[model samples]
Target: MSKYDPLSGHLRRQREDELELTFAEIERILGAMLPKGAARQQWWANTTDPHTSHVQRKSWRGAGYDAFLIAGKERVRFKRVR
Candidate 1:
């Protein structure tokens, strides 16, 4: 069996299943919410503290801020906060 086959049984037993998004749907949302080209690119490239969602670029201090919104796996919708 394939490597993925072993995980299939476990994955199937999960309380929640993966959600699929169509390319068109993703494009539409990004088009409306994301800032133009360069800004959007910069945002995704930056990684911050996953817990506080604070950016730590250039310093280890907890002063940096999140530049984008994201939804946790258990979250039903994306919440924008800065």
Candidate 2:
């Protein structure tokens, strides 16, 4: 299962198309601690389905959302696209 599945369901229930969440919040949704430097680099590179490859760098696309960083990478904002 993709780490973003839980978060996808949460956002869908909220009826929100665009939302931002802190790294801590993301961890809670994923039910695991994020890898080091998760708030940096290309963590927002959501293009491919994460379940397709456990080592893939793709972000939220597996959950049907496009993601990007905000507040200088302090938070992530995901926009529903599917």
Candidate 3:
């Protein structure tokens, strides 16, 4: 599977209302450790606008998903917008 497949698979299995996932859950799904800043708000920013170096995470957008921080970085919600 590709590095992004885990997240893509999870999104594929999601119900219409089943959005949002914890950062830990995402890390587990990826089967690997995330970057130190993975839990930071800037890590998941909509970078399609201004370019950013955190391009690896753009995988979520490639799969039609977007993330929003909740509970001050305790968790993140992966919402499918497309």
Judged by TM-score, which candidate is best?
Answer: 3
Q: lDDT tens string, model 2, 1-82? A: 5675676666656567788889889789778887766666475566565354533234355445677778566788878885
Cα deviation at 1, candidate 1, in Å, is 42
Worst 10 residues of 3 by lDDT: 49-58
What is the C-alpha lDDT profile of model 1 across 9-76, one tens digit per residue?
Answer: 33234343233333233335334332333233343344544554322121112222222323332111
Off by over 4 Å in 1: 1-25, 30-33, 37-40, 50-82
| Reference-based lDDT, residue 43, model 2 | 55
lDDT of 2 at 69: 74
Candidate 3 lDDT, 1-82, residue by residue in tens = 4675787777767776447777788889989777777667777776675365555556777666777778575677777775
Q: How close is candidate 2 to the true structure, as a TM-score?
A: 0.67
Enumerate residue pairs that collide in model 1. Answer: none
**TM-scores of all candidate predictions against the true structure:** 0.21, 0.67, 0.71
Sort order, lDDT high to low: 3, 2, 1
